[model samples]
Target: MSTARDYGLDEDYEWPRPQEGGWIADDLDELPHLPRRTELIDGSLVFASPQTRFHARTVGLLERALVEQAPDTREVYRNFTVTLNERNRPEPDVVVARAGADTGPKLTRLLPGDVVLAAEVVSEDSVDRDRETKPRKYAAAGIRHFWRVEENDGLPVVYVYELDPATKAYGPVGVFHNRLKLTVPFPIDIDLTAVDRRR
Candidate 1:
Protein backbone atom coordinates (compact mmCIF):
# COMPACT_ATOMS: atom_id res chain seq x y z
CA MET A 1 0.00 0.00 0.00
CA SER A 2 1.18 3.57 -0.65
CA THR A 3 2.26 5.47 2.43
CA ALA A 4 3.38 8.94 3.46
CA ARG A 5 6.97 7.80 2.88
CA ASP A 6 6.15 7.04 -0.73
CA TYR A 7 4.84 10.61 -1.13
CA GLY A 8 7.89 12.27 0.44
CA LEU A 9 5.99 13.38 3.52
CA ASP A 10 8.04 13.18 6.70
CA GLU A 11 7.45 10.12 8.83
CA ASP A 12 6.25 12.38 11.64
CA TYR A 13 4.06 14.48 9.31
CA GLU A 14 0.53 13.53 10.13
CA TRP A 15 -2.21 14.65 7.77
CA PRO A 16 -4.89 16.93 9.20
CA ARG A 17 -7.81 14.63 9.47
CA PRO A 18 -11.36 15.90 9.22
CA GLN A 19 -12.98 16.89 12.48
CA GLU A 20 -16.34 15.64 13.62
CA GLY A 21 -17.67 19.16 13.41
CA GLY A 22 -15.67 19.82 10.22
CA TRP A 23 -12.49 21.89 9.90
CA ILE A 24 -12.68 25.54 10.83
CA ALA A 25 -11.47 28.33 8.54
CA ASP A 26 -8.48 29.09 10.78
CA ASP A 27 -7.17 25.54 10.41
CA LEU A 28 -6.32 26.20 6.75
CA ASP A 29 -3.74 28.85 7.62
CA GLU A 30 -1.97 26.64 10.17
CA LEU A 31 -1.60 23.41 8.21
CA PRO A 32 1.92 22.60 6.99
CA HIS A 33 2.67 21.73 3.37
CA LEU A 34 -0.92 22.19 2.28
CA PRO A 35 -1.44 22.50 -1.47
CA ARG A 36 -1.98 25.90 -3.01
CA ARG A 37 -5.54 27.16 -3.45
CA THR A 38 -6.80 24.86 -0.71
CA GLU A 39 -10.23 25.95 0.59
CA LEU A 40 -12.54 25.15 3.47
CA ILE A 41 -16.14 24.34 2.72
CA ASP A 42 -18.38 23.29 5.58
CA GLY A 43 -15.26 22.67 7.67
CA SER A 44 -13.64 20.35 5.10
CA LEU A 45 -10.57 20.91 2.97
CA VAL A 46 -11.25 21.28 -0.74
CA PHE A 47 -8.30 21.31 -3.06
CA ALA A 48 -8.42 22.91 -6.47
CA SER A 49 -7.91 20.91 -9.62
CA PRO A 50 -5.33 21.84 -12.25
CA GLN A 51 -6.45 25.00 -14.01
CA THR A 52 -7.06 24.81 -17.73
CA ARG A 53 -6.00 27.32 -20.39
CA PHE A 54 -9.55 28.54 -20.86
CA HIS A 55 -9.99 29.10 -17.15
CA ALA A 56 -6.73 31.01 -16.89
CA ARG A 57 -7.49 33.23 -19.86
CA THR A 58 -10.98 34.01 -18.71
CA VAL A 59 -9.83 34.87 -15.19
CA GLY A 60 -7.04 37.10 -16.51
CA LEU A 61 -9.37 38.94 -18.81
CA LEU A 62 -11.92 39.52 -16.08
CA GLU A 63 -9.32 40.67 -13.59
CA ARG A 64 -7.82 43.15 -16.04
CA ALA A 65 -11.20 44.55 -16.97
CA LEU A 66 -12.27 44.93 -13.36
CA VAL A 67 -8.99 46.55 -12.39
CA GLU A 68 -9.30 49.10 -15.13
CA GLN A 69 -12.91 49.98 -14.39
CA ALA A 70 -13.17 49.54 -10.66
CA PRO A 71 -13.21 52.85 -8.80
CA ASP A 72 -10.45 53.86 -6.42
CA THR A 73 -12.61 52.74 -3.51
CA ARG A 74 -12.70 49.19 -4.83
CA GLU A 75 -9.74 46.90 -5.45
CA VAL A 76 -9.56 43.78 -7.54
CA TYR A 77 -8.09 40.51 -6.35
CA ARG A 78 -7.54 37.19 -8.09
CA ASN A 79 -7.74 33.81 -6.31
CA PHE A 80 -8.15 35.34 -2.86
CA THR A 81 -10.20 33.58 -0.21
CA VAL A 82 -13.17 35.28 1.46
CA THR A 83 -14.03 34.15 4.95
CA LEU A 84 -17.78 33.74 5.22
CA ASN A 85 -17.74 32.22 8.66
CA GLU A 86 -15.81 29.87 10.90
CA ARG A 87 -16.33 26.92 8.57
CA ASN A 88 -16.52 28.42 5.08
CA ARG A 89 -13.79 30.18 3.20
CA PRO A 90 -13.88 29.76 -0.56
CA GLU A 91 -11.73 31.54 -3.07
CA PRO A 92 -13.39 33.06 -6.05
CA ASP A 93 -11.62 33.50 -9.37
CA VAL A 94 -11.96 37.30 -9.18
CA VAL A 95 -13.02 39.43 -6.26
CA VAL A 96 -13.81 43.16 -6.14
CA ALA A 97 -13.36 44.16 -2.54
CA ARG A 98 -13.56 47.47 -0.78
CA ALA A 99 -10.24 49.28 -0.66
CA GLY A 100 -10.26 49.14 3.11
CA ALA A 101 -10.12 45.36 2.92
CA ASP A 102 -6.57 45.51 1.54
CA THR A 103 -4.85 45.32 4.91
CA GLY A 104 -1.34 44.63 3.61
CA PRO A 105 0.86 42.13 1.79
CA LYS A 106 0.70 39.58 4.59
CA LEU A 107 -3.07 39.52 4.87
CA THR A 108 -4.52 36.16 3.83
CA ARG A 109 -8.31 36.55 3.68
CA LEU A 110 -11.19 38.97 3.22
CA LEU A 111 -14.47 39.18 5.05
CA PRO A 112 -17.72 38.92 3.14
CA GLY A 113 -18.77 42.47 3.96
CA ASP A 114 -15.56 43.74 2.41
CA VAL A 115 -16.52 42.30 -0.94
CA VAL A 116 -18.68 44.04 -3.49
CA LEU A 117 -18.64 41.29 -6.05
CA ALA A 118 -17.38 37.71 -6.33
CA ALA A 119 -16.92 35.95 -9.66
CA GLU A 120 -16.07 32.43 -10.73
CA VAL A 121 -15.07 31.06 -14.10
CA VAL A 122 -16.65 27.68 -14.55
CA SER A 123 -14.30 24.80 -15.27
CA GLU A 124 -15.09 21.22 -16.13
CA ASP A 125 -13.85 19.97 -12.78
CA SER A 126 -15.73 22.63 -10.81
CA VAL A 127 -19.02 22.73 -12.64
CA ASP A 128 -21.20 21.91 -9.68
CA ARG A 129 -19.30 24.07 -7.20
CA ASP A 130 -19.17 27.05 -9.49
CA ARG A 131 -22.73 26.75 -10.70
CA GLU A 132 -24.41 25.80 -7.47
CA THR A 133 -22.45 25.47 -4.22
CA LYS A 134 -20.23 28.54 -4.29
CA PRO A 135 -22.90 30.90 -5.52
CA ARG A 136 -25.33 29.66 -2.93
CA LYS A 137 -22.79 30.29 -0.19
CA TYR A 138 -21.82 33.69 -1.57
CA ALA A 139 -25.45 34.71 -1.64
CA ALA A 140 -26.04 33.47 1.87
CA ALA A 141 -23.08 35.50 3.03
CA GLY A 142 -24.79 38.64 1.65
CA ILE A 143 -22.42 39.31 -1.19
CA ARG A 144 -24.13 41.88 -3.40
CA HIS A 145 -23.16 40.50 -6.78
CA PHE A 146 -22.09 37.24 -8.38
CA TRP A 147 -20.99 36.23 -11.87
CA ARG A 148 -20.58 32.80 -13.38
CA VAL A 149 -18.55 32.51 -16.57
CA GLU A 150 -19.06 29.54 -18.82
CA GLU A 151 -17.10 28.62 -21.92
CA ASN A 152 -19.32 28.33 -24.97
CA ASP A 153 -17.58 27.55 -28.24
CA GLY A 154 -14.33 29.06 -27.01
CA LEU A 155 -16.06 32.22 -25.88
CA PRO A 156 -17.20 33.23 -22.41
CA VAL A 157 -20.85 33.60 -21.47
CA VAL A 158 -21.31 35.49 -18.24
CA TYR A 159 -24.38 35.01 -16.09
CA VAL A 160 -24.82 37.78 -13.59
CA TYR A 161 -26.83 37.77 -10.38
CA GLU A 162 -27.89 40.35 -7.83
CA LEU A 163 -28.65 39.41 -4.25
CA ASP A 164 -32.04 40.37 -2.90
CA PRO A 165 -31.67 41.52 0.67
CA ALA A 166 -35.23 40.69 1.58
CA THR A 167 -35.00 37.08 0.47
CA LYS A 168 -31.27 36.54 0.91
CA ALA A 169 -31.26 34.87 -2.50
CA TYR A 170 -29.84 35.80 -5.88
CA GLY A 171 -31.93 36.99 -8.77
CA PRO A 172 -30.74 36.80 -12.36
CA VAL A 173 -29.56 40.20 -13.49
CA GLY A 174 -28.44 39.51 -17.04
CA VAL A 175 -26.47 37.23 -19.33
CA PHE A 176 -23.65 38.76 -21.30
CA HIS A 177 -22.44 37.18 -24.51
CA ASN A 178 -19.97 39.44 -26.32
CA ARG A 179 -20.00 42.42 -24.05
CA LEU A 180 -20.57 42.95 -20.35
CA LYS A 181 -21.83 46.32 -19.15
CA LEU A 182 -22.93 47.02 -15.60
CA THR A 183 -23.56 50.02 -13.37
CA VAL A 184 -24.68 48.53 -10.11
CA PRO A 185 -21.55 47.63 -8.12
CA PHE A 186 -19.71 50.17 -10.22
CA PRO A 187 -19.62 51.50 -13.74
CA ILE A 188 -17.99 48.78 -15.86
CA ASP A 189 -17.76 47.58 -19.43
CA ILE A 190 -15.79 44.64 -20.77
CA ASP A 191 -15.38 42.81 -24.05
CA LEU A 192 -16.03 39.19 -23.29
CA THR A 193 -14.82 38.14 -26.72
CA ALA A 194 -11.28 39.38 -26.12
CA VAL A 195 -10.11 36.35 -24.15
CA ASP A 196 -8.23 35.01 -27.17
CA ARG A 197 -7.03 38.39 -28.40
CA ARG A 198 -3.47 39.67 -28.12
CA ARG A 199 -3.11 42.15 -25.32
Candidate 2:
Protein backbone atom coordinates (compact mmCIF):
# COMPACT_ATOMS: atom_id res chain seq x y z
CA MET A 1 0.00 0.00 0.00
CA SER A 2 2.26 2.75 -1.24
CA THR A 3 0.90 6.16 -1.99
CA ALA A 4 2.33 8.66 -4.44
CA ARG A 5 3.76 10.66 -1.56
CA ASP A 6 5.66 7.58 -0.45
CA TYR A 7 7.51 7.79 -3.72
CA GLY A 8 7.97 11.57 -3.34
CA LEU A 9 5.35 12.50 -5.85
CA ASP A 10 2.09 14.35 -5.72
CA GLU A 11 -1.01 12.23 -5.19
CA ASP A 12 -2.50 13.31 -8.50
CA TYR A 13 0.68 12.89 -10.47
CA GLU A 14 0.56 10.92 -13.69
CA TRP A 15 3.73 9.47 -15.18
CA PRO A 16 4.83 10.79 -18.52
CA ARG A 17 4.39 8.22 -21.25
CA PRO A 18 7.48 7.22 -23.17
CA GLN A 19 7.85 9.03 -26.47
CA GLU A 20 8.85 7.28 -29.68
CA GLY A 21 12.40 8.60 -29.67
CA GLY A 22 12.51 8.85 -25.88
CA TRP A 23 12.56 12.13 -23.96
CA ILE A 24 14.67 15.04 -25.02
CA ALA A 25 16.92 16.70 -22.42
CA ASP A 26 14.66 19.74 -22.23
CA ASP A 27 11.62 17.62 -21.31
CA LEU A 28 13.14 17.00 -17.88
CA ASP A 29 12.61 20.63 -16.85
CA GLU A 30 9.08 20.73 -18.25
CA LEU A 31 7.99 17.53 -16.54
CA PRO A 32 5.99 18.03 -13.37
CA HIS A 33 5.87 16.01 -10.14
CA LEU A 34 9.07 14.09 -10.86
CA PRO A 35 11.01 12.70 -7.92
CA ARG A 36 14.17 14.25 -6.65
CA ARG A 37 17.38 13.62 -8.60
CA THR A 38 15.56 12.49 -11.72
CA GLU A 39 17.91 12.14 -14.69
CA LEU A 40 17.26 11.76 -18.38
CA ILE A 41 19.44 9.14 -20.05
CA ASP A 42 18.92 8.42 -23.73
CA GLY A 43 15.48 10.03 -23.43
CA SER A 44 14.32 7.86 -20.49
CA LEU A 45 13.79 9.03 -16.96
CA VAL A 46 16.01 7.43 -14.33
CA PHE A 47 14.97 7.93 -10.74
CA ALA A 48 17.55 7.73 -7.98
CA SER A 49 17.16 5.16 -5.26
CA PRO A 50 17.13 6.13 -1.62
CA GLN A 51 20.50 7.32 -0.41
CA THR A 52 22.69 5.10 1.76
CA ARG A 53 24.73 6.41 4.67
CA PHE A 54 27.95 5.44 2.97
CA HIS A 55 26.94 7.23 -0.21
CA ALA A 56 25.86 10.36 1.62
CA ARG A 57 28.94 10.68 3.81
CA THR A 58 31.38 9.94 1.04
CA VAL A 59 29.77 12.54 -1.20
CA GLY A 60 29.72 15.06 1.65
CA LEU A 61 33.40 14.66 2.47
CA LEU A 62 34.38 14.86 -1.16
CA GLU A 63 32.25 17.94 -1.75
CA ARG A 64 33.65 19.60 1.37
CA ALA A 65 37.23 18.82 0.40
CA LEU A 66 36.74 20.00 -3.14
CA VAL A 67 34.99 23.17 -2.07
CA GLU A 68 37.75 24.05 0.36
CA GLN A 69 40.51 23.36 -2.15
CA ALA A 70 38.90 24.49 -5.41
CA PRO A 71 40.10 27.76 -6.87
CA ASP A 72 37.93 30.87 -6.89
CA THR A 73 37.12 30.33 -10.55
CA ARG A 74 35.72 26.85 -9.87
CA GLU A 75 32.66 25.62 -7.96
CA VAL A 76 31.40 22.37 -6.46
CA TYR A 77 27.88 20.95 -6.55
CA ARG A 78 26.14 17.72 -5.60
CA ASN A 79 23.23 15.81 -7.12
CA PHE A 80 22.85 18.15 -10.10
CA THR A 81 22.30 17.03 -13.68
CA VAL A 82 24.69 17.70 -16.53
CA THR A 83 23.30 17.93 -20.05
CA LEU A 84 25.68 15.78 -22.08
CA ASN A 85 23.58 16.06 -25.23
CA GLU A 86 20.01 16.14 -26.50
CA ARG A 87 19.22 12.72 -25.08
CA ASN A 88 21.53 12.22 -22.09
CA ARG A 89 21.49 14.15 -18.86
CA PRO A 90 22.92 12.31 -15.88
CA GLU A 91 23.61 13.67 -12.43
CA PRO A 92 26.98 13.00 -10.90
CA ASP A 93 27.44 12.56 -7.15
CA VAL A 94 29.78 15.53 -7.11
CA VAL A 95 30.57 18.02 -9.84
CA VAL A 96 33.32 20.62 -10.19
CA ALA A 97 32.60 23.22 -12.84
CA ARG A 98 33.72 26.62 -14.00
CA ALA A 99 32.32 29.41 -11.83
CA GLY A 100 30.43 30.83 -14.77
CA ALA A 101 28.10 27.83 -14.81
CA ASP A 102 26.74 28.70 -11.39
CA THR A 103 23.94 30.86 -12.74
CA GLY A 104 22.50 31.53 -9.30
CA PRO A 105 19.39 29.81 -7.90
CA LYS A 106 17.29 29.23 -11.00
CA LEU A 107 19.78 27.19 -13.00
CA THR A 108 18.65 23.67 -13.86
CA ARG A 109 21.64 21.99 -15.48
CA LEU A 110 25.23 22.36 -16.63
CA LEU A 111 26.54 22.14 -20.16
CA PRO A 112 29.28 19.59 -20.79
CA GLY A 113 31.58 22.40 -21.82
CA ASP A 114 31.19 24.13 -18.47
CA VAL A 115 32.12 21.15 -16.35
CA VAL A 116 35.73 20.74 -15.25
CA LEU A 117 35.57 17.48 -13.32
CA ALA A 118 32.80 15.01 -12.54
CA ALA A 119 32.88 12.49 -9.68
CA GLU A 120 30.66 9.59 -8.77
CA VAL A 121 30.67 7.82 -5.41
CA VAL A 122 29.68 4.33 -6.42
CA SER A 123 26.50 2.92 -4.97
CA GLU A 124 25.26 -0.65 -5.21
CA ASP A 125 22.57 0.22 -7.74
CA SER A 126 24.81 2.48 -9.84
CA VAL A 127 27.84 0.30 -10.50
CA ASP A 128 27.02 -0.29 -14.14
CA ARG A 129 26.18 3.32 -14.87
CA ASP A 130 29.15 4.70 -12.94
CA ARG A 131 31.73 2.22 -14.16
CA GLU A 132 30.67 1.61 -17.74
CA THR A 133 28.15 4.10 -19.06
CA LYS A 134 28.83 7.44 -17.41
CA PRO A 135 32.59 7.57 -17.86
CA ARG A 136 32.25 6.68 -21.51
CA LYS A 137 29.61 9.35 -22.11
CA TYR A 138 31.48 11.99 -20.14
CA ALA A 139 34.66 11.34 -22.08
CA ALA A 140 32.83 11.45 -25.38
CA ALA A 141 31.35 14.80 -24.41
CA GLY A 142 34.88 16.21 -23.91
CA ILE A 143 35.00 16.53 -20.15
CA ARG A 144 38.64 16.59 -19.16
CA HIS A 145 38.63 14.93 -15.74
CA PHE A 146 36.65 12.24 -13.93
CA TRP A 147 36.84 10.41 -10.62
CA ARG A 148 35.14 7.26 -9.44
CA VAL A 149 35.02 6.66 -5.69
CA GLU A 150 34.36 3.29 -4.19
CA GLU A 151 33.92 2.20 -0.60
CA ASN A 152 36.46 -0.36 0.57
CA ASP A 153 36.84 -1.54 4.17
CA GLY A 154 34.52 1.34 5.05
CA LEU A 155 36.85 3.89 3.49
CA PRO A 156 36.95 5.77 0.22
CA VAL A 157 39.17 4.64 -2.65
CA VAL A 158 39.40 6.99 -5.61
CA TYR A 159 40.19 6.09 -9.22
CA VAL A 160 41.08 9.09 -11.31
CA TYR A 161 41.11 9.53 -15.08
CA GLU A 162 42.14 12.12 -17.65
CA LEU A 163 40.74 12.42 -21.17
CA ASP A 164 43.02 11.78 -24.15
CA PRO A 165 42.25 14.52 -26.66
CA ALA A 166 43.19 12.55 -29.75
CA THR A 167 41.29 9.44 -28.72
CA LYS A 168 38.48 11.06 -26.74
CA ALA A 169 38.85 8.35 -24.14
CA TYR A 170 39.91 8.45 -20.53
CA GLY A 171 43.40 7.37 -19.55
CA PRO A 172 44.03 6.25 -16.01
CA VAL A 173 45.58 8.94 -13.91
CA GLY A 174 46.00 7.10 -10.59
CA VAL A 175 44.24 4.98 -8.01
CA PHE A 176 44.29 6.57 -4.59
CA HIS A 177 43.39 5.15 -1.22
CA ASN A 178 43.65 6.70 2.26
CA ARG A 179 44.51 10.07 0.72
CA LEU A 180 43.71 11.67 -2.60
CA LYS A 181 45.94 14.38 -4.00
CA LEU A 182 46.01 15.74 -7.52
CA THR A 183 47.54 18.67 -9.36
CA VAL A 184 46.15 18.54 -12.86
CA PRO A 185 42.56 19.55 -12.12
CA PHE A 186 43.27 22.53 -9.93
CA PRO A 187 45.20 21.05 -7.01
CA ILE A 188 42.86 18.83 -4.96
CA ASP A 189 43.81 17.06 -1.75
CA ILE A 190 41.40 15.08 0.39
CA ASP A 191 41.70 12.75 3.36
CA LEU A 192 39.68 9.79 2.18
CA THR A 193 39.35 8.47 5.73
CA ALA A 194 37.37 11.55 6.71
CA VAL A 195 34.19 9.81 5.65
CA ASP A 196 34.19 8.13 9.05
CA ARG A 197 35.13 11.21 11.04
CA ARG A 198 32.49 13.04 13.08
CA ARG A 199 31.50 16.21 11.29
Off by over 4 Å in 2: 1-6, 10-13, 102-106
lDDT of each: 0.89, 0.89
Question: Residue 167: error of model 2 in Å?
Answer: 0.6
Listed in order, each prediction's TM-score against the native is 0.91, 0.93
Question: Over the stretch 90-171, how does candidate 1's per-residue lDDT look in tens digits?
Answer: 9999999999895324488999999999999998878999999999999999999999999999999999999999998999
Report, for all candidates in order, the number of backbone clashes: 1, 1
Give the 10-residue window scoring lowest on summed lDDT in candidate 1.
1-10
Candidate 2, residue 100: how far the Cα is off, in Å: 1.5
